[model samples]
Target: MRTKSPWLLFAAIFGASFLCWKLALEPHARSSGELERAPATAQVDVPPAPRATAPARADATPSAAPTEHALPPSKQRVRVVVRLAADASAVAALGAELLRVDERGREHAVACCNDPLAPAPVGPRELAELLRAQRALPEQREATQRFELAEGGRYAIAWHAWRHVPGTLTWRTARGAGEVFELRSPFTCEERTLELVIAPEQLSLDPALDAPVIDAVTHVTAKDG
Candidate 1:
């Protein structure tokens, strides 16, 4: 066993210290190179866009127009008066009413025959013709007759024409002709006792006055031979 010298031990320790110092210096050099590189930039804020209120449209519905005729009533009553012209005139002259009232709450008239249940026309031509024929009838003549006023004497004219000619009649608000008639008759009788009365306003018993021509012909058909 030879004793080791202090100098040899010192040399060995110095070699180990040098190796640790080299390893520490290499890492510090790498960190210094990274720091020298470019620094990162900061980010900026941006606002969003606004949205639209109304979008593209495809289809839509339009409003409708108003009507002229009155709606059908729940309860309705029609009255007709047939009067010979003479009687109707007499009633009008005396300032007396043309309608008459009965005990059972029914109205009667001699000057004007009241038909409470008049029918309605199918179409415009039919309506005009109905009105034209009705107006031309003797009903108006009797409405002006008689000179006495009594109860149940409220009279009105109404008619229901079923048939109509295609090319014969037409109707317009201003001045066009058609077969549609506004079946509105005057009311002037009020008698409870009389069961039935036929007071056509006028008696146009003249044969010369041909049947008021409608569409160059009459609506009714001729009797078969």
Candidate 2:
């Protein structure tokens, strides 16, 4: 018999070692954590049904309708026309002409044209009396006597005469010694259009002009509705 070859001996030893590992070695070793526990079956939950929303109907009316009483349409514009004298002679002439104008002839005659000494209207009379008393005191007389015209003229007259002048109360221009015309309305009226005609160079400059006389005529306009 030939001696066993070295390779045959090595094969026998390796096969026996593998068989021992499979049976005895594997049974004795402790198991890893993953291998010992069975993999849990994957859990899946079913979702619930969604609720449905209703759509808007065509018959429903909206909440924002407008009311009936809106404001009246605006007027384009409103105005007052105040005219100053165009000519001093014309204004003076108007004062003279007032004596003949018949509308309120009696009132004008005594106060304006005929008698310069006639007493004034009741309210004006009281004022005149007060002024006369002041003038009699001497200190106030100089101031009461002379009134400067805007166009550089002065009238030196008794206090009672100035207080009784008719045109001064009614907003008229006095021409000479007879004429007086109403410049504007003293009542409530609406004029859609107004044309102011001022006389050429009639406006004057004198510091002594009475402010109350000018303001009562020119500044006030009737209030609007």
Candidate 3:
């Protein structure tokens, strides 16, 4: 008799294994309906369905959205313009000081500027401009300062000016009777503008040329929306 081939023996073992696996999966596939059959009777297992969650309580409350009213007060930009009038051709910038006042009638010097003042030399054309504007002397515009002011804050401006005589083209560094513009401001709101003018006629300046009076017209406006 001829001996069995090694290839024939391997084929017999594979056929027996395939038959055992088919018999074991057929019973579970029919009863549970979980295992699915694909092409050529390939088995595929299916997972169980997820459980349902319980409903929320009827007494539960929802969250609310934020509003603009919850924001803090914003700061405002403050601009102060100062102008001086005299017959002099040139004037030196004596520096201006800004004061921040507390609620208890106390003042604090905050900001200051030493920028040079502008000069207006007199001439035939300048005379015409002065005559057209109905002014006795050419107005000397000085440097401006900007600061950030808070809401519901109090402030004052104390400026120093050098002494100069009217109709004289000379400007000296000798300072005279300089006064402070004490302000009880109502800047609680950000929508306020002020224009304060102190002319020659409004003040009784010193007769002596050594001590000239401080004449200033300050215009402050809020630069905020």
Candidate 4:
């Protein structure tokens, strides 16, 4: 066999090594370029989180409807004339209070009329103040004069008689409805009469029978004939 030349053998080995390095390096460079150029994965649009909401309440109360109505004109009036009488032997003066009573039995004083002997004007504000003061001083005197009644509702006539001696007083409506009250000397006698007045749209009581009549025991007199 002929011996191979040393130079030729060396040259062959060097060429093979260079070829292997080129192949390995070229693949690595290509892989790096591919990574740099690859489009960034489309940023997935993350939807915003939903907002929190409050739950509806189960026990909320509904608003109430108004219960007040307009009052009728003053020209359409329910005249309430009052008369008082007593024994000729006695001297007396009578004052009256008109009240509105609701279905619930709550009393609202609507008007007050004083006898000519003790005259004073009592309005809604004055009556309210008197009532408040009465809680603190039950014996306080409240002065009042005649007032107009406009609205129709259940009403009451409270009469007070000032007399010189202890006695009894009688109260009656023109319709024959009546009540009695006891009087004390030096102090006033008080009585109440309840009556219903129909609305303007309905039949009303006879105007002639709409007055209140009061009578007292002997020795006492009434200012109003």
**Clash pairs of candidate 3?**
none
lDDT ranking, high to low:
3, 4, 1, 2
Deviation from native of the Cα of residue 64 in model 1, angstroms: 35
lDDT of each: 0.28, 0.27, 0.37, 0.33
RMSD to truth, every model = 43.5, 49.0, 38.4, 42.0
lDDT of 4 by residue, 32-124 (tens): 677666332211111222221322111111122223336423421222233332211111222344545677876555533433322336322
Q: Give a tens-digit lDDT track for model 2, residues 78-157.
A: 12122333331112111111121344443332233232233454232333343444344422111111111112111111
Best by lDDT: 3
lDDT computed for candidate 2 = 0.27
- Candidate 1 accuracy as lDDT: 0.28
Better of 1 and 3 by TM-score: 3
Worst 10 residues of 1 by lDDT: 172-181
In model 3, the Cα lDDT at residue 224 comes to 46
Query: Which portions of model 2 show Cα errors greater than 4 Å?
Result: 1-100, 103-133, 136-178, 182-225
Per-candidate TM-scores read 0.15, 0.15, 0.32, 0.25
Runs in model 1 lying further than 4 Å from the true structure: 1-73, 85-201, 209-225
